[model samples]
Target: MGRHDDETETSYITVPSFFKCPISLDVMTSPVSLCTGVTYDRASIQRWLDGGNNTCPATMQLLKTQDLVPNLTLQRLIKLWSDSSGPGSSPILNPPSGTKVPTKEEVNESLNRLMTTLSRDDDVRIEILTRIVRFLKDSDTNREFLKKKKTEFITLLVGIIRMKTTTKKKMELVLMATKILDTIKPDRETLSNLMLNDDGGDCLTAMLLAIRRGDQDSKIEAVRVLDWISYDARSKLLVAEHDGVLTETIKLINVTDSDPSLIEASLSFLITISKSKRVGSKLIAAKVISKIKDILMTTEMTSVSVTEKSLKLLETLSSKREGRAEMCGEDNGRCVEGVVNKLLKVSTAATEHAVTILWCLCYVFREGTAAVERSNGVTKLLVVIQSNCSVMVRQMAKDLIKVLKINSSALSAYETKTTHIMPF
Candidate 1:
């Protein structure tokens, strides 16, 4: 463990993005949340406010209430994570051995209490829900025990969320509910009822609200819930048909200083929804192509997982003619160049996805040859043909070379054997 003191600090753990102060980008000393649902280190925000700034540093929203509530749950989470990682982890964070889980009765009572506590302050409700989310996240046993009461909890949560309430009063509750549903992973039939015509789409509507107005956690959970909801065949169309779901999700990608986890969730959700052909044109209409290019072009902001998924999503979108045209035609050479760049740069999965995309554009469609040639894609293709890549990838690389009308005889210098025949 790295030494920790009052002012300067260093640590081995890769601190969670949210754990760091927005202004300082260091692990928060005393984390606090503002009215806008953004959290920051006490000293950093205090300095910001002392500098005569009236807007939130993160959202730039005009300050309505400058009240800074101590984010006790977050503080505890940080401590728990720190303790767990820094050599002397508490039993709660990393249990020594498994023990008996809570009985069904105890779980039911807790759900019933949350259901009946309408008059309870929002703070209490959030705290209770936070503990539950943390507990569920800790291990599989906690999750499995809670799974038995998943239906009751979901029903109660639905009722609580559906109440006539103002946005400010209910956002936390709704967000927590979304997180719970996302964690518990309710059955497809249950999600279909809540997200589709059968149940008036209340849950789905709340998801949009979370995406639009919620804090970072809420936004991530919202997309996560939608990602799960999209898995049900009926809900995929509902998600696509919803006027704002696709638009709002695309908006998440463009937020200034956007969280990578949120973007990852958004990309995953888009991938799931993109499986249906009906949403392909709509996604293109919403400028998803440009947004994805922005992701691929910036290797710094994205994680390897994000890179892999982006390529996969791009490949999925390539199945549409408009998607292909947008990438190879309207985008000049950037799109093809990005694909070529990933040929040997990323993982095996990413390389696989990239070659498939290149093949579609340069070979199958025959419209991307100029773009590929401009990108020196032939060089990348030749490299792929000679790499220790999958057999399918090697063949696709050669086919792409032929499409560009490049001579394959040059392979003799690189490959000892004919690519047309097997190598021992």
Candidate 2:
């Protein structure tokens, strides 16, 4: 009771007696029950057990065991009560009823009505599309149903996006369609059809516009669709041919407040586009090099997928003279430092790409060789060779080390470090 007295004296807001933990006398976020039939917040009880006490705080009854059973029903009721009540001591309202899941037939009917309404009137089209989007968000089964009819949905979506409607409702319809298409992931043939539209591929144009003007969620969906489309070589070329696709994609990378998923989609699209040398050069021209380097140096890039995609794109870009020059030319040496730091720090895929970037720099550009040697890149490469890297990576590391040894005298200082020596 000593702790209860201190807690009660400190709390200004009056908590319901049942809602307070018996041990801490505070409202519980996670309530659990002891074997003695007394409830306490999980953390408070855990602390009590850790302190070697085996008695219930409320009843002082001996507890047979320390195991805590979660009170899920109570937790939900507490959350509901907290949400409804307020400082003025208002009465708590009952939680709303859960929406029932729509059946597959109902989902199909909604889609049919949506397609039919598109031909009827603008108001009907917008309302139906909104309902469809809500249904799509309801469950994965609804999304899979839409995927089964991907051809029909893709055609309709492409047509709606191609129409030059600028009304707010029309724009909302376009955004919803984009989100649904992204969820369905139409096959390569369907995507090819979108690119081959008679209106000279207006679908890609519409997506670019969405990336530029839509809200964050819409923009994310647009980029995800674009990423899926870019899986095909022809589709990749079509996307790169668009004027703003590359620029807007890099802009998304630099967006400070974007969700991690959005940046991931943007990075994925860039990784696909970077497969083409022509498009890779365009990315370089758009100042993508510095932006990618910035991502590597900052703490924001914590997702391993993001780091891997960025590294893969860097590998592709580094194969070009322009990319190598830009990376080696950074005033603060972050580009080289970032690649070197990832030598064995990230996943195997990332490490391979990082080594490929270093290889390109060391062999393709004369200035690159000197810059890398100066950045302690040779030491990192040697570490990779000695570590438990894949055969391909170890070979690449050895090849880079040979290039360094042949090109510069700086490697001689670390000659004794090569325990797993490679034959020339």
Candidate 3:
């Protein structure tokens, strides 16, 4: 006879049975993981069963105590049963012994139980969602499942994003959602309504703020989303309609340190608007040139990598005709001079940053030949070429020296010709 109900409770927490074994599917006998934390150990179950009670130690399910058998026989049966099954079978379960049986109803029941657990609690939801997303990566049919649940998935992700809680949890959810969204390949038609139905100016503003709030990973993800929206053709056209987007991007670069990815993204966004003179004018009017100058001139003697990238970006900025005009013009010329002085100083002092600085100098001189001549930039550059240790920097410096000399000769010939042809 079964033990007293209270006895069963204690035994349930302690023993294992045939039902708990592979025979009846209670607690696993000697649970061993085939993959991840999922297990199929019959020994643990058999040990519990060996304790004289036939109850699943894990779930408290009753089992056939009479079916006690050695581990070798169970292993043999497991191999024989699995071998008889068809090409496809559950990775966790061994094949059936007597016949190939379908468990559609049982599988669905287990999934229903899991779904209930997932929906009833936030922690359970996050855990379940994490596992399912990982499983989806392995399953070919997950695409179909995702297509069917696209709206639901997006809604769930939006809910998580909106949830007010710890930053870590929020970031975890963000990463999960981004991975799933990428896998599912959700259409813009979905996010467009939530992210773009507004003028999108507000959405852009909010994303920028979120980017600054979290740590590196969160900010990187945030930047990805912003870059997606910022560079989208439709959004790009729409953003171009208002000057605020360009102004905000320029401001972001100015305030944020030299993040190469962000700088590159901002530069790309700037490139998109450069197609239109009005957009370019708006970018210029927003003081992009001055800010770029500031970035280029920063001589904090800290964060050399950032300074290197800033120098490269400065070269890019100063190369543009509009950029050069702004650089050589009244209010901004001093900024350019400051940038040149820093590049020269770093060239002599910092071997590594020196090469980059010299490379950028070459780019600036090459692109802004007229501006360099007007600003008398050649003499300073020549001094660096004569003394710098970095070979590339010296080479670039020498190149600029050659260009300045050639221009000087051309200017002299023109002047001499003009003098000889006086009164013509």
Measured with C-alpha atoms, the lDDT of residue 387 in candidate 3 is 63
Mark the regions of model 3 whose C-alpha exceeds 4 Å error after superposition: 1-194, 197-206, 237-279, 300-325, 330-371, 374-424
TM-score of 2: 0.69
Model 2 is weakest, by summed lDDT over 10 consecutive residues, at 91-100
List, residue by residue over 137-186, the lDDT tens digit for candidate 3: 65557555655653655656545554554455555655555555545555
Q: For each of the candidates, give the backbone clash count.
A: 0, 0, 14
Which segments of model 2 are wrong by more than 4 Å?
1-100, 117-119, 199-201, 299-301, 364-367, 406-424
For candidate 3, the lDDT comes to 0.49
Note the Cα lDDT for every prediction shown. Answer: 0.73, 0.71, 0.49
lDDT of 1 by residue, 1-424 (tens): 2223343343333456677665544577699999999999898787667757777876678889888899999999888777765454322321122221223343454455465532144543564465567667767877877777756677766655555446575777888777877777878577656555454466667778888888988899889877876765567888777769999998887534688888888989999988888887889888888887887777575678878888998998887889988887666857767877777887888988998898877777787788778878888888887788777678777878888887768755554433543210
lDDT of candidate model 1 versus the reference: 0.73
lDDT of 1 at 198: 59
TM-score of each: 0.69, 0.69, 0.42
